[model samples]
Target chain A: MRVRLRRQATLLATVAGLLLAATPVAQAYEPVNIVHTEKVQAGPYPITVGFSTWPLRAIQSLDFTFAPDGGIEGKSGTLTMTPATRSTESRKRPLVRHPRKLEVWGLDIRALEEQGDWTFRFRLDGPEGPGEGALTLTALEPPGPPMALNWSLSTLPLIGLVAFLAIAWRRTRAEVLAG
Target chain B: MDLTAPGAHGVRAAATPRTAARGMPTAMALLAGSVLGLVGLTWDVQWHTDVGPDTFFTLPHLFIYAGSALSGLAALVAVLGATAAARAGRPLDPTVGGASVGVFGRTFTAPVGYLISGVGAAVFLLYGMWDLWWHGVYGFDAVIDSPPHIGLLLSGIVTMVGTIMVFAAAAEHRWGRVGTDVSIALTAANVTITVLGLTDVGGPVDAVHTAMAWLVVILLLTAAGFRPTRGGAVIMAGWLAVIQAVTWWFSPWAAYAYADAVGLPVRDYINGVPVMPALMPMALIAVALLIEPILKAARAHGNRWLPVAAGAVAGALVAALQGIQDSIVYTYPTPGPGTLLPTAVAGALLGALAGHLGWRFGHMLRLVNRTRPEGN
Candidate 1:
């Protein structure tokens, strides 16, 4: 009886170990696949750009590449986003039909002035459209502040007065209680 | 005869009976201090930037010149006097006679009142440049609405400062004197400005809106002057409703008129994308009006449902406006998420119901004596 119980326990342990090992492999599997790729070079840096032909049936896969002087020191960038609701039109339309641009906001990049080829390589599981394509865009200097400092400085006195009041109030309150 | 008495300085002279001696001085002092302070603010030849059709210029901008500089000067004087008194060994006689100046200059301090009033007025007036430059109201592209687009970097800073001052005065009750008076004055000014806009005098609506912005400030001051009451709540709600109606109906009319003046046959297109925009402002105003009633009802009745009902009313108003606007705008029944009618209707109904019930069960459950103290 003891030998039979030990054999059953060993079998259970082995099966659990196998399931744990397969978990990552299963999770990594995605429906959207990237096929074509392009690397735009600016000096030493490289920007790898990629896109899918159709809206991904489901985003099943994604990968990124970091080029030297791309301001991102190493291959250490991640992309995460939700897709817009897929309408019937989206299914009927090809990925390249319109400007299917994946707009990324708040990229914490420094030394944008540094000349280097920055490439962003990405993969997506798309609908039955262009499996994948790549495009390159140049980084340009952003525009100026909407209102001039001269315009804003007009309110500085108001700002300063409020600050003064707050400080004075605190001091007076303390003195009044102490006295 | 003794000015040293608690109420002597602030009350009517004994022999004079009707005329208040002390109150008069206090009032005069506040007025004089503010005017003098106004001079002091402009004492320095400061180059005030005005955003115009062209780039930034040192030329006098109406709002910056009038509102910020003048009001800011008044605030400076008031603050200086108050601070000086605070620094002096006089113990800062806040409760002069019968007037109650609460902790940390809560109610009107003579100097503080002047300063805040001036600055508040100035800030309120400065909206002309903002409207012209940001919203592209004068046939400019909508893209100029962006912060970086207009070269007015300090827009955010000025807005933040103004907002803080407005809120601070409201919180500190300095609003009772400076903020309130300024708001009333501004509202009156706005009424005139709107008339000018209606006449199409060929200028930005800054003058009109600058005046209009004072309406909320005045209403708030009036509300604060009175105790919390069903009537006051209703008044607040009514004010909000009026604002909503005006924003919805009048704003559209105004926009259409402007479009017509510019030679665009947009009166019929008013039912288009314009209608959708119209509903947003209306719904916003409706929500503002109903929020207080729901809370008050919830507190008075202890009925958790009162707020819910109020919210439903607000939501219904919003949804109806949105539907009306959408029907005007869209010719085809695009039954999807992006469609204006369905989205606005759903939002209004759900929002009103949820907000009413949520608030009823939440805050605004306390009933204070809702009555206005006759005169300040």
Candidate 2:
């Protein structure tokens, strides 16, 4: 009887696994979705900036693609992202091959941590020599409720916990001590 | 059943170590959650490495939250039971815990360990909120040393400490030995994880931070040896090795599996070993064995400074082993903006303090049941 039940369970699990495996592919992370683009002429090279999410917001994950005219071949590039908000540090990243796209350089599922204007400075070095250009990106407030409000709502449970501990201790301290 | 545990009459019947230790089962259960969370943390690191920055609601996040929830739930159960026991007009046994602090007009009672664990869970929520905000402001930078991450790791350490204290309080019982030893291993894991954020392995400054963590390990292991039931430190060392093996095996494998299952295969699948706490070589195990003769000598000769000496040795050894480990795994040690001398000095100083504290804490745990409250 136990063996029969075990075999049935195994069969059920396999079916479920197979069903999940057959589900439609989630394009959420694999393919880069270019929702917006900006053009920059780095000396003789004309480079295009592709953003997965337009009107970039702080803390929201998005992808970025930098495709130069003709192709990325015979050309190595570098990216330096500097936020207008001086409070945050600047980041220097090399133009690596995009994971999914494979033809261009991109940052996959990366988020801008702060809301403000950001400068994307690119240096493309290839057969045309080293060409440099910069573009300003304005990142507005993130989607959904304000950050403060979200934090306030998230911390309610912590406050409740503190209050409960206080009340429980107050009512019990006198009674337990005298007992 | 433990002899001193509550009789059939209930928790009110006796003021014994068993009654105090009533929460041992809960504490151990909480440990499972912590271990799960540590696993998730390690897996999460590997995920971030092989895969790029992902959404907040990823599989790793789920595992972390679930583990935190399980730990929080277990601690909450212990607290509620203790408070109910106190409110029912039963004075809590001191060995286990009792009404120690009052909040506003209300006073709650429980074992100190459970109380601290509960507080840790609450603090974790606060850190979670901070982490969310930090991500919004800082973006999804992969480095571990964010303010919120540090806070989260500290809260985790506090939670682990609470577990250790509970077992230490119940040191009289057989359960306490296993509990304390296991707790020691987990705590060491937690401490190492926290230190990793502060230190970059093989870097001059980073190496010192790694070496400084030897203080806690020495203290805990030394404390374990202080118990009537000896060899606990060695057992804890074994647990550390197990932590390394389990994490090393699970992190990369799970990262790949989860990423594949979710339809987002890794961008760069080819990688070196995963970087996480407890994934490194078991340096503490060797240190543990090496210090035994020293600890024994201290006891045998009544030499007060020997434990401190052991701490110093462990400290220096930690620095040396960490350097060697990083050299083998990553690149050769770099002087990255600093020299190695400061690290050596800091390790010795921290080790000396840890040695002294370990002896003190070990003694305290040994005598946990004996030092009852004044009225009790």
Candidate 3:
């Protein structure tokens, strides 16, 4: 009876080892994909955070996505985005969109106050468990038009002014000569 | 105070000095209004640079409106007063008679300068409406050279010129040297404002562009100098210096106080550094000094080309001096001959044009004097 119990225990141990080996492979094969992945870490439970727009720039729209190790199908929580520079205050809102094709939580931001590093903090309480994490990014200003364009636009009023002066001069000259 | 005296063309001559002195209050009101407008404009620009756009009814905007309203109202009152005098068989006061024009089946009268200034004020009011609409559609301008802003500046210039004209005519009356001095000072003030407005385009970094802008400014100043007023250059220089000093002293404090009041984060406050006043005025003053002697010589000789030559020389000096000053101030690379050549040429052309305009304005003054009624 003791020998039979030992054989059963060894068999159970072997099956457990096999399941552990396959767990990572299963995670790798999951449909969850993150583009421009800024950060991926476990916060009690696993979470992936990244910007939707690559190479963040000032005066441009910003889009961010957060996904947990488990699919977002049954997730419920809030995301807060704060500019690290404190030039503007943080914006806090709950996640509502669960795009069927993308299968990830998403948030769209229109414009940042100024160019600098900004921090994004996330909190999620879902069926898998509670999760929290933070990510930081640098916002750069986009390249402007050439110096010539700036010069042309700046000096455009001079033309109108000169024309006005010329017309006034002509009228004055005529009146004087006639008199 | 006998007001009945008919001159040529069925127009009445000016009222006696005693009667005309009553118009001094109206003149003072116009002058005060103009100063308010200038201050409001400068403050508005600074506000935009520091705090970005605020509401349409911002304090600076209200100041500007008040100025226009006051100046326009004063001008209208003067016109109405003159018309009433003329209809009642009284001679029009020279201050108002010189500016009268028949319109809308009624004879409207003010100093010619005030008449033109009032029209400019009306135009400015219309443009203000347009500017608000423009901001709504295209968003607030990141730069100052927008169409509405240009229109506003032009109207402001017209108003200022009218003020100068009114003062000039008054000086010829019993106001004497005092009126002339005030006119000269106002001319200087107007020139200073123009230079300030053009700083966006004529920044010290762009040598050629700065030269071009200064060329135009120098021409205008030269034309203003044509007035038969002594110490024209000194008045221009004094006003420019005073304005610069006041701006440098006040701008930084104002900006800081405003930021603190608004609760703007220290990191977000851009107006901590006081704006550097433009040095182009100093260069123009140098030209003005040199031209004074040339103007005297030209008048003594009755030499037609002398003023033109003087203008050209002044323009060239302004361009060259401004180029050097800009290079030093902005730490810009030395401008090549190519840039210098074009700037010099433009300056010369503008100088000649200025000379012609100056000659014409002087001639107009002479014509007015010739046509005036003989003394009682």
Q: Tell me the alpha-carbon RMSD of every candidate.
A: 25.3, 8.2, 23.6
* Model 1: share of true interface contacts reproduced: 0.00
The CA root-mean-square deviation of candidate 1, after full C-alpha superposition on the true structure, stands at: 25.3
Per-candidate DockQ vs. reference: 0.01, 0.13, 0.03
Which lDDT tens digits does candidate 1 get at residues A74-149?
Answer: 2223222212221221111111101111222111111112122222322223222212222332333222232355
Clashing pairs in 2: A113-B137, A113-B139, A169-B106, A169-B107, A169-B108, A170-B105, A170-B106, A170-B107, A171-B106, B20-B96
Tell me the tens digit of each residue's lDDT in model 1 across B1-376.
1112122123121212122232223333333333322221121111110100121221122223333443354444544544454444233322111211222433233322333344444544454465454333222212222322212212222322232222223321332233223322222222221222222222322222222222222232233222234443334434444433443443344434433333323211122232212222233344445556555655566564554455555444444444444444555453344443443444445644444433421121111101112222
Highest DockQ: which candidate?
2
Fill in the DockQ of model 3. Answer: 0.03
> Where does candidate 2 stray beyond 4 Å?
A1-64, A70-95, A98-103, A109-179, B1-22, B91-106, B199-204, B207-230, B277-281, B331-341, B367-376
lDDT of each: 0.32, 0.65, 0.55
Per-residue lDDT, model 1, residue A79, is 28
Q: Rank the candidates by DockQ, best first.
A: 2, 3, 1
What's the TM-score of every candidate structure? 0.34, 0.72, 0.62
Model 2 local distance difference test score? 0.65
Candidate 3 regions with alpha-carbon error over 4 angstroms: A1-179, B1-9, B173-226, B265-280, B327-338, B362-376
